[model samples]
Target: MVEPAHPKRRRAASWILAVVLAVFVTMGAVGCSPSLGSPPCMPPEYRVNPSSAKPGEAVTVSAPDATCNPRYGSNAQIRIVFTDAMGVEVLNTTAPMTDKGGFAFTTEVPTPTAVGEVAVYAAPEGVDWCDDTGTNNRAGSGEDELEMASCAKPMKPLTITK
Candidate 1:
């Protein structure tokens, strides 16, 4: 006949099994789970040298380096738009993501055909919500625009002139 297992031995075996199971669960969670969402994107700092320009003149808009989704998302892009007085998009360019988590972009102003009080606007790509009629929008051409309502500081739309 087999002797009954000792109480202390049984407890020890149970404790070891519990520990092993816990380790597996923890490991799986750490290795398999996607990263938690990163902090919201910082409002890009934008500047244009020679704030005023004539139609077809080259202007430069430079802003300090920044991150969109930081390390959490790929395919992140920044779009810089130049709008003429007629509220028409004259130049719109999308910059590619850099290998590092940050992206600092500088581009020469696109030449405008319409001229007269041109403005520069910058934004992250792939946004769907745009309000042209609502008060939550910028005054520009008919393009749909999303109001970045929750930024730490209200972003002033950059502008240039002819």
Candidate 2:
């Protein structure tokens, strides 16, 4: 006659099976799971309302209704660079991120040292959520790496009228 299985052996075998099943279930869930209603990743969008400002005038830079990839989520930071006609940096500031993943900043142009145009550039710094190349290259792929919402164009020429 065959001997019955020992109680201790049965219990231990059951526990091991349970642990293995749990691990398999977790892996399956992670592998085949779909994203549940997540926002699309997009490059940070920015715009300076006028795109041009006179010396001593206050200009508003806006990052409106923007979305970042779920990978980055809401951990992105925006920076604005204001440069003069001679490519001299005038103002560099970090704008505050909004609840909707947007930002806005207001800065006054400094008195002109000389009469010429000033250029402004808005870009996103830190992690980039808009990257979709799947290479996970957040540094960007050249000039296209960062989003250029609006350029100063010719930037407004400053005139020192006495």
Candidate 3:
């Protein structure tokens, strides 16, 4: 019988290659697992002045420059949504982008049947939620962040009182 040269080295190399292949396969499986959902979008620099306010009071909502992609240009607009504790749409308004790609608008707070706190968010008018494009269609891996679009975040909760 003819024996191969350096049998021990060949065996070790084969074993190592098998282990590496297995690890790669396992990683790919977990990364592409459908159990994971799209990763959360990156938070914007949204802010609500006077975090607390009364019904009908004027409050300013502003997002600093670079909050939203300026690529949208001058025509771009941001929708400022105010949702009450009950998940009610208390106020919804659109603010035009400033020269610096930032937005500032003042609007009166709306009265909701149940008012303890209200969440203020500024969403880019034409932006979409982040989605996973991986084979498994899962998002939890955070790879979505690289391709994510603008995402709104809750500013300091606005308190509403009688």
Note the Cα lDDT for every prediction shown.
0.53, 0.56, 0.64
Clashes of 3: 1
> Candidate 3's residue-wise lDDT over 1-162, tens digit each?
987779899999999999999986875555323344422332246778888878888899887775322344567677788888888887787889653347788988875525688878776665442333322212232243444435434456778877
lDDT of model 1 at position 28: 53
lDDT of 1 by residue, 43-149 (tens): 34666666665544556655554434223146656566776768887777887543222345555556644646666766545432132232222223366654654
Cα deviation of 130, candidate 2, in Å: 8.0
Instruction: Compute the lDDT of residue 143 as modeled in candidate 3.
Output: 40
Winning candidate number (TM-score) = 3
Off by over 4 Å in 1: 1-37, 67-69, 72-75, 97-112, 127-162
In model 3, the runs with Cα more than 4 Å from the true position are 1-44, 67-69, 129-156
Better of 2 and 3 by lDDT: 3
**Tens-digit per-residue lDDT, 23-118, candidate 2:** 877755553123433323444456665655567777777767544432323555566777676667777787766534477888777775234655
Q: How close is every model to the real structure, measured as TM-score?
A: 0.46, 0.50, 0.55
